[model samples]
Target: MYYNTNILKSTDGESICYYRWQANPDVPFKGIVQIAHGLGEHAGRYNHIAHLLQEEGYSVYANDHRAHGKTAEIKRLFGYYDGKEYFDDCIADMYALTNLMRAENPNSKFILFGHSMGSLLSRKYVIKYGKELDALILSGTASFIKVLGTIGLVTASTVKTFKGRERGNAFLKDFFFGEFNKKFKPNRTKLDWISTDEAQVDLFEKDPYRTEDFSLGVFLDIIKNSKKVNSPEAFKATPKELPILMFSGDKDPVGEMGKGVTRVAKQYEKYGISDFTFKLYKGGRHEMLNEINAEAVEQEIISWLNQRI
Candidate 1:
């Protein structure tokens, strides 16, 4: 069964909206999995995945991050102000929800599954609270911000210098679609999964909960946090024995740069962190969970969790 509710996080004064899929509530659960979605998307998009997990005898919970989906915030589609605040709020909110879930199911193990930007935040949370989780899965992850930070810094400075000036969405278009400019026209509608699914693309464009733009300040904040997470200090903070699963698509742009998912694993290996597994999907894209053969991906995830947890 599916249930939706909101929990007021006293820690940050933000009401976190979430969904819970109860699978075999009577029988003791093997574990609980919390999902964190990528940018421009909301937790509701994972309804199908939640159902699948439920069928697999696992309770699933997902929350829409602040400034995204039904969460309260300014600048509708774009997040303004401190990006670290966003990350902090997300961690606090996740912790709060985990506590609540644990209270209800005391015997179940806890695991976290994060995608894209969410994967970045998951790593930060793990470094701080690694002992609390049994396992972690990072999908479509990379070690760097991919120039979004540089563009955000410039735009943030411009906004600060010229108060009351509004910048166009040209930066977003350029940063996300600049490479495909010659091959295909830059239409905001085609920004789903970097694939050819017109129907899915249309759904994404029409989704009211989806955010397409972010404030210069918020973008810069994310850049700063991203850098911190990739730093040697943060890498060292993570326990060497914590089991981590990292996966990404070979064709995804995150894998295009020298800072691909494998690069992330290699960095950790350099620090003697060997309790991890990294996989690359041959032709998958950024949103592997939403791809054509999502079952294959889901099965892979379940198999990993079964072995580790």
Candidate 2:
């Protein structure tokens, strides 16, 4: 399956560069998979996953979120949200893309796949627009720690007050990701915590788009939204009927070594989302999709989707 790169106008008139992988023309269309990538990465990183889904008769679409990937390149606003409504704006842009996909395949099931920070955005999305999706897949997701989130938000805000929102705060960046690589003692690189696969980490380090330092404002936005998604009210607002699959590595620091991921699962159960599934890969790190056992992880995802659709 091949993909086409196109631009879509977001709700606020931001130009969102997206990729669309149409399912095999000869095969019956199965469904639609909209991918939301993690922070500091582009939608293009998931092209292989899109190909797999397209081959399985599912059309795939992924957009470069604001201040990331091609969209950031086009706007020249790398790592800058440019406004206070950063998180909401990203969700709106996602909804815009969702509407486009639904318009093209009105009868097909729609699945939203989000990884890491994207997973947080997707969680927020379900609260407002859960009915718009047939299912949800969250990768490298976690339940937010309220106390730490509050401190991070305050710290980021203070930094932005002293410096500028557009200036990248190396201290804030370290504060967020510094501890992630600690588990992997004598780490080969700073991003070894992302995946056990050294090659993937190398590729990430080499990719210019992935190397962009996030601004303090971006950190603040992420912390604020992370808290929102983890709130009990947000859980109650989620559509209980929507099927959700949450998967992560046991060693993923973002998931707090799997404890946070488990907490999220329990929250879903408490909120009456009976059709929720949680999977933890032993010894796996943050980015299971790029890990050594990535093929197995991909197969597991496909198997789950097949059962659902």
**Which number leads on lDDT?**
2
Error of 2 at 274 (Å): 1.8
Q: For every model shown, what is its TM-score relative to the native structure?
A: 0.85, 0.96
lDDT of 1 by residue, 1-309 (tens): 365756546466656777788876565457898888877688888888787777777888888777677663423434333444557777888788788888877978888988877888898988888888888888887676556556655765666466422333456535644542223345444563444446666777788787756544445445667778888888888878777888877667654522457778888888776678888777666667766667788888888887876
In candidate 2, stretches whose alpha carbon ends up further than 4 angstroms from where it belongs are 146-148
Per-residue lDDT of 1-309 in model 2, one digit per residue for the tens?
A: 378888999877879999999998777789999999888899999988889888899999999988898888896778776666678988999999999998988888999999999999999998899987889999999788666677788888898888877778887777777767887889889898999889999999898787447767788888888888999999999999998999999999999899999999899999899689999999999999999999999999999998998
Evaluate candidate 1 by giving its C-alpha RMSD to the native, one decimal: 3.3
Specify the poorest-scoring 10-residue window by lDDT in model 1: 72-81
lDDT of 1 at 34: 89
